[model samples]
Target chain A: MIKPLTGNYAAAWGARLARVGVVSAYPITPQTTIVEKLAEFIERGEMDARIIRVESEHSALSAAWGAALGGVRAFTATASHGLLYMHEMLWWAAGSRIPLVMAVVTRTIGPPWNIWTDHSDIMGQRDTGWLIMMSEHNQEVLDSIIQMFKISEDPKVFLPGIVGLDGFILSHTTEPVDIPDQDVVDRFLPERRQPYILKPGDPLIMGNIPSDLRDNVKMRWDIHRSQERAKGVIRDVDREWAKLTGRSYGGLVERYRCDNAKYHIIGMGAWVGDMKEAVDILRDMGYGIGLVKVRYVRPFPGEEIAETLASSKGVIVFDRSVSPGSAGPLYLDVLSHAYIHGVRVPIQNVLAGIAGIDVGYDDIIGGVTMFINALEEGRWPLPSKIQWYFGGGEWWP
Target chain B: MSTERYLPLARPVVGVSGKTGTWRIERPVINYSKCIKCGLCWLYCPDNVIEIVEGSAEYVKIDYDYCKGCGICSNVCPTKAISMVPEG
Candidate 1:
């Protein structure tokens, strides 16, 4: 059934279908509706679950961790400062191999008290051992949440997965979403497995206990192995979901007409939707341009990316976050992977959006021009080191 | 399975002293006069560290070398055939 809902409502419905027993999250802008709807569901007796109103994001994650350890399906959502506040527990949840799902509304990490869409909040937490998935539309945000539970709870990949939707852009905007039937969801996602249970009668020690360096290394290696295993599980889950729901994800990174194209544009989150329109405009002008929407960022999708960019003459990587002295994070990953694959494609790195700055079509066109010029000149574009600003002013153009 | 699953720590290997199986709580000696066909010690040892003597009056034997001092056999012995002793 097609229901008109905001991205936050989609996320709430997905969590509801997953039958999350405990939800412990403090409200932050753009992400508050997810928990609010969940609380409403519980109050109306529509959903049989515990909805906790925690004091802070830190306590929210801590409570979710405890509930998950007790062998119950759990979830939480946060944005910007809430995500930053829960940073320590993020590592704790992943390290303990608790299969909890978190919705991260992409917002700028603040010093100036801004609450708008930006990738820095989630991007800054790239090393938190969680499998991160970016949502392009409200539908993806909804579906990704349900799929995240299955992906995270897989025994081979017992790490947490975070679904990221741009705050205000996707979270607040309403769109058409297919809310799966409850019976269908129950068939797709059976009860979560309790292999690592923490029963009161059968006591077991949880995380942060003292252990030898070798034990610690073993734990870390398993965490790395789980992330690597998640790469394959993510693809497999997408394939399976397509069979059940008649909807399929493009897997890892979704490619758009890049097979025979000479120039490919790369980005994540809501920008990809804008880039799609831009790709069509460039394509009609006979520019041979395409787009690669990076849905999964942490696993990096190196092999698939290398193959996608292999035949392209040039590639432009649009980053939403910046590194102080180096190329943006996305640029480094794509360039490094391309180099390893022996592909000599010129990569133009463009730092377009930062600190909630709106990335317009002009920025996209300028980025494409740089990429084409680099290819024509037979030179790999230098790593992006520009800082964009407001007031129509130039700082590092 | 990866090598990491067997060892809780990331190291390659651990020495025998680190192995918890070598410590013993009780040492059993065969008493033929009190021996019966009942194999209570062999059935009750949690670590499966007990052995039964074959065709020698069905006496029960405990392998003290691998026991971890978890006293289950002594408590389960119905004939007072086994006793718990501290291992130095």
Candidate 2:
């Protein structure tokens, strides 16, 4: 069914279609609507599930973890400070290998106290052992949430996942989204089957401390191996979704207009749409520019990114958040991928949209123009510095 | 061996590696004379290590292999038959 829905509503619909058995959530901006919709679905008898109303995000995720551990599909949603508050349980969920799905509305982390669209909240959890995927549109938000369950519950990758959408940008904005039929989604995503389940009379210990230090190391290694294995599962699930829904997001990273491009731009989430428009304008101006929208940040699509940007002369990366005293987290990942693959291209980092500053197509086009100009003027490397575009500063040293 | 590392489905297998009985600084000793065989200790053991032997002289036997000696069985015993004594 086609309907005008916000990203939060799309995610709620996705959870409903997935037939999530248990939903535990605490209300926070942008993400509150997603859970509120779930509550409505449960109360109205539209969905058969338990809505665990928790006092804090920590308990919210913990409840979901318990449900998932009991061999049932579970989901939760949070944003910004709420996600930060659930940091410890986030590790618990992933380390315990619970195939739980969480929708994170990416919001700015506060000290100055602002609620706006930024990647800092999700980026802050880069190493938390959860599979992270960002959505560009409301449709993708719905589709990715459904696919995340399949990917995370795959035998090769029994890990938790986080589906992130920009706070207020996609969360509040209404757009036309096609909700996949429940039967079609069921065909694409089967009921989750993990190796172990907590059941009465068949007792098993979970998340127990290992006696030998090597066992702990082995557990961490298993998580790492599963993360690496998830790359394939992600692609497989995307293919299945495409066959079922006629829409595929090009696996890990979606490339646009990069066939004969000399310059490329890379980013994740809603800002990638703006970058695509910027690329179009730059292409019309004969700049030979393209855009690579990184859909999955965790299990970083390094090889695919390198292959896509192999022939480009220079690439510019847009970061919505900073890593403080260093470079943008996305920029660092791209730089490492480029370095390891021996694709010695001049890559520049443009730090924009920090603390929710609006970054339009014009700002993106300007940044791309600056990078291309630098490449032509024999200053290709641009002194290896991070530039703050539309961030009230020229560059940070 | 694969089960030893991040056990699949996170199912905790029995008697695999660690003998949690080593964690017991104080072990529970059941005084069978006062034991009513009410099975409260069997019901209260968090580790599920208490087994009730109906026909034997010792009606209750604690599986020390996995018991951490939490004293829950002692606390739940109605007749004060189970006492947590310090390990020698």
Candidate 3:
């Protein structure tokens, strides 16, 4: 059914269609309505599931993890401070290889007390062993949520996942989303298969300190291998879902107008849409550039990225979150992939939307224009590798 | 990196921490004559090492492998039947 829904509603519908067994989340701004609508679904009997009202995000994820451990598909959602509060459990849920899904409406981490959209919240969890996906539209958000269950529950990738949408931008904005039929989703996402199940009489011990330190390190390596293997599983699942639902996101990284281009622009989440617009405007002006939207951050499409960078004269990367001491997180991932793939090219990082400041196509066009001019003037690897773009005609080159 | 198993799941086994009682400075000794058999020590045990042995000659049994000998049982015993004796 096609209906006008916000990103939060799309997530709730995604979980509803996936036939999740448990929904546990603490209500935070921009994320509260997601659980509220879910509670409505349960109260109205439209969906058969348990909505656990937890006191904090920590307990919320724990409850979902517990439910998943019991051979049930589980889900949860949180943002900003709530996500940080659940940080400790993040490693616990992933390190244990629990199969579940979470909707992380990305928000700015605060000290100045902001609740706007940015990648900082979800980006912070990149190393936590969960499949991270950032979507461009409300439909993609809904679709990715269902696909995540399939990817996460796959035996090859038995790890939890987070489907991220920019705060307020997607969460509150209304757009028409084609909610996948429950029967079709059921066919695509079969009955969930968990690694272990908890039974009352038959006891299973977990989380105990290992006698050998190697045993502890082995678990981390296993997760690493499974994550690499998930790259194929993600593509296969996307193809399967496309066959079933007539929608495909071009696998991990979606390339647009990248053919015969000398330069490429890269980013994730809602801003990628704006980047596309900026790329088009630049293209019309006779600039040989394209946009590469990173849909899946983990099990990163590094091979595809390196392939594109290998041909391009120069590439520009936009990051919503920075690693503080180092460069932007997304930039670092791209550079590492470029390094390993032996793709040597002039690439620069643009730091924008750090605390949810609005970044429109205008900012992208101007900033990228300067980059293109620099590359054309043989000013490759211009003075510094990073630039700060803070909208309103202000950016440091 | 791992032998037989790939995941971290383990079966509930004894002496997981390897005879933790060796770290205890004082041990609890129960006097059967003044014992109330209240099961308070069993309930109050933090490590769950104490068990109420109904028909055994000893009033209660403690799994010393996991017991830290923290003297929790002696402190909670109301009948004054349990004593924390220094380790020799």
Which candidate's TM-score is highest? 3
Over 4 Å off, model 3: B1-5, B33-37, B55-59, B64-66, B78-80
Chain B TM-score, all predictions listed: 0.61, 0.83, 0.82
User: What 10-residue stretch in candidate 3 chain B is worst by lDDT?
Assistant: B1-10
Model 2 residue pairs with clashes: A196-B9
Off by over 4 Å in 2: A390-397, B1-88
- Count of backbone clashes, every candidate in sequence: 7, 1, 0
Which pairs in model 1 have colliding backbones? A214-B9, A214-B10, A214-B11, A215-B9, A215-B10, A218-B10, B25-B69
Give fnat, all candidates.
0.10, 0.48, 0.74
Q: Which is the winner by DockQ between candidate 1 and candidate 3?
A: 3
- Arrange candidates, best DockQ first: 3, 2, 1
- Model 3, span B4-88: residue lDDT tens: 3367778886776678989988888889888878899999999989988888768788787677889989999999888988989
- Write the residue-wise lDDT of candidate 3 on A1-397 in tens digits: 8999999999999999999889999999878888898999999999999988888999999999988888889999999989999988989999889899999999998898899998888888888898999989999999999999999999888999999999999999999999888889988988888788888988888788787888888888888888888899999999998999899998799999999989999999998999989988999999999989999999889999999889988889999988888889999999999999999988899999889989999999988888889888987666678988888978775
What C-alpha lDDT, on a 0 to 100 scale, does residue A59 get in candidate 2? 98
- Candidate 2: global Cα-lDDT? 0.89
> Taking the tens digit of each residue's C-alpha lDDT, what string does model 2 give over A235-303?
988888899899999889999998898889999999889888898888999999888999999889999
Best model number under DockQ: 3
